[model samples]
Target: MPRFPEVAESSVGLSDAVFSRLVARARERGGKVYPLHVGDTYLDPYEGARAEAIRSVDHQRLHNYSPVQGEPALLDAILAHVDRRSGAALDRELVQVVSGATAGIAVVVDSLLSPGDELLLLSPFWPLVRGTTQRRGARAIEVPFWDRLESMGDAAAVEAYLESFVTPRTSAIYVNTPHNPTGHILAARHLDAIASVAERHGLWVISDEVYEELWFDEEPASAWMHPRLRSRSVVVHSVSKAYGLAGARVGFVHGPATAMQAIRGVQTFVTYCAPRPFQLAAAKVLTEGRGWIASTRAHYRELAHRAADALDVPRPPGGTFLFVDTRGRRRDGESAFAFLERCVDRGVLLTPGTASGKDFEDWVRLCFTTLPPDDLHEALARLRQVLDDR
Candidate 1:
């Protein structure tokens, strides 16, 4: 049943507009629509790291294409930042700067996975990773995680549960923490379980550390820092989440030298290079934004607790979101989408939980950092009314 000039099968059912309908509804209603759906900060980035700070007068070829790998300055900064955070002495050749973590992961998928290969995607994950796998003609095997960590009991049990989902076709495991949606940071024991499973299967570990700098309590150890996972892991990082420079589109990926060779090759065919000016900006942030990160972390922690208290959910350990199960609060015969519509009617927008995982259809994800304190408080107040009315 082939038609002329048909699109690829992989593109089917993939959506880049998960929030379009809700956003349209919000637009129609007018007034202030608190955008709690997207994961972004209301605060501006550090002054020196901002795009406006980069000037043609200061740097040569400020708008030109950077080298395929990346600008040397940004790469050096990433190496130093990684060393400080994880204490790993990475070779300079092992790093590849890309447009962002999304594209970085895509390049990884292209390099490592063949069609029909499986990626062990821990859920509820960052929404885009699922589509990233699908676009590669690979399947994302969702193991209900993060939200189920406490109920899953010990690390051994977690390992057993994850391993049970693996099959001969599974080629890699994607790990993110402090996780999106739920915001639970994986402890060492959990990483041990993941490493054990990946090592036994000889599968690659794709460590997503974009939220690495956003932890609330103690600093979390990187997955690549684990002895067993070290050689097999390829870690991805972004300045977007921590520095509030999402529009800059700068992220870096590093791994074993051999694996990085293929990733860099794929990067050439993808975006070629991240924007040169933003690379300079990202370097500035990596080197000079620690104090900014500390103050922002404290601010985010307070906001996280406040939002959690308002929603009556457990406070997130890190990351920007609170994944709430709205099932209990739903009216009889009302669907998950209906509950979301009720919230939007009150001028508050939330991401449907089904965006994160197939098993999370009855849940909703809220970003406390998306709005400033006064606006966020008002949004929560409107949301509370909807919850109470049920």
Candidate 2:
């Protein structure tokens, strides 16, 4: 065994920064690299929100650490937003603020999942979810859904998966709506189907709704809002994508008052509390930044549509990305890494599907946010050339 307590084998490994290392090496050689890989917006912080942050930093109270749960003002604002949107009529005590959605998920996994417990992951998932669950020594079992979006769109398929796959050892079910790689938003029927599964199995539903506000055709149904599902579900949301405050790193989780208390206990040990000034900025954006999310969504939606038109693959239903499939030229399987490499040879960069799971080998997740019309067009054009060329 290796040193350091035998380092319990876990799945989480290597940050997406691995791509940056590759891109950096290419740059050093004067190779062109267009970075479409990460979901992060190249867009600068929302101007108004940034100004508020700078101003808040000047406030004497911000220099100190926040309360272990969160600052009262920020916490209350989050609760009000949740009550309004989730339509769950939750009290302030049910919410705990954290550094980001990722941190909130960590608290949930640490509190609820145990070693050997089967954790249900809905693939293609965001990479961090897989990393966090496995790091806890819990087995991550993926229930492939979106790849069969056509079939999964029929609620019966999702219902069957839930009915057949969940076992007594299943501790949690993770839902990523406005899903990461495929960009499929979970509809009310889908939520109803999942809620039924959770209700029957007595499982915890950990819903990551960081992109809830970015839904394309309709509003997303909150799992916590389902009457039968409310008691067993915890909802996580962030100011990053919607408010263009990714750097602020402020998010909240709300659910059962009992579970909220447990999350607070976990939060105390990890981050203590989110940064005071960042919380202050997020609070303002949530309560007063309506125009910001709308403008950003419209801008991103236009770009996403353009990407779909440009790429050879079908478009994702709704989200900030277009997951492109490029498998025509390869004899072995065409992986996201291989596709990304091809794009990099040109002047474009995109994330490989392998980061999510081996299942996404043919899928390339390309972020369409922040790039101006001309730049997005150019990037897509370059991507086409890379795939079409040798």
Candidate 3:
């Protein structure tokens, strides 16, 4: 039989098996489901995105092929925004724009590691991080964090916990603050500990800050703002969550000039460049839309609280989702899939926590910003009813 190789087929990322089934069944049932599973926003693109998209329609350069690193205007605008926010003046030459955060992640993994090199990861992570590493023939050494992080208040203790998992083959560490699926933002001391460990080991740090602008209770923190880690970090940021521009598919990664050169080179074939019109639209948001960004963040913050209250979950300090702990709440012999199936039967769709990692097998994720206030309330009522009946 003609078949795929082991490396190509070994990981199918079936973590989403429950989600896929729910989606398929929802379509087959031929009616609407109250969706809290995805991170999509109920809002439109930012104030100026559509205007820029329209303006770029007649520009020939925006229509034709451009440098793989991205359009100059877009790159400068991004760096300017970064400098204003992080107080780190970066050289424009060190930045590379790509199709989206997903593409940016793939580019970094492929560019930074050789086959068999180990990439240290934090869990529960965005599944894409693990999938990309494995596909690049790299090993992922996971340090389970989310479960114990909130309880481990000491920064040095958190650093020590991460250090125990490191080995000689480890080449890089990935940090996702305002983390996906859980929406837990790492504290400043936690960021410092990770930075200290990375600096001491001479390991690369891939900082994913796509949710940088969505902090609700307090200001967000980043390793990019740390002086010691700046020389060896790849800071990946995006407009998808912040500006409601996910469909535009624009994101970028920047770091030390030397490493970015390699990352930029890898982009010559992979993605090549972000779509120009979208880049122009994103550039508008990056350079001149802080007020709009602040308002959007405020809106999501309000929704976050409402969702947390409805789900009976602790409100995350930041980000747009609430993580509902269903550990002892599940029926005997019921798997995460069965719990989610009941939510579906009750007409609300949620992302089973197992999809992100097994560490979260007893939880589920629900996004607050994805539905209107009343719809969100109704959706949670359905979810709550299912759990109550269980």
TM-score of each candidate? Answer: 0.98, 0.91, 0.93
Tens-place lDDT per residue, model 3, 1-390, is: 325553244255425355788877666666668888888888887767874454644667567776788888898898898888788778888888988898899899888888789998888777667878887878877777876787877879988888998888888999888888678888778878888889778899999989888888768656577777778899898889988998888999998877898899888888788888888888888987888888988888888887777767777777777777787777888888788877787778888776666677787888888898889888978877887876
On TM-score, the candidate that comes out on top is 1
TM-score winner between candidates 1 and 2: 1
2 or 3: which has the higher TM-score? 3
- Across residues 121-228, which tens digit of lDDT does each residue of candidate 2 receive? 888888788878878888788777777766665566678877787887898889888788778876667778888888778888998888877866556666556677
| Candidate 2: residue 87 lDDT (0-100) | 66
Clashes of each: 0, 3, 0
Rank order (by lDDT, best first): 1, 3, 2
Q: lDDT of all predictions, in order shown?
A: 0.92, 0.76, 0.81
Cα shift from native, residue 368, model 3 (Å)? 1.4
lDDT of 1 by residue, 287-315 (tens): 99999999999999999999999989999
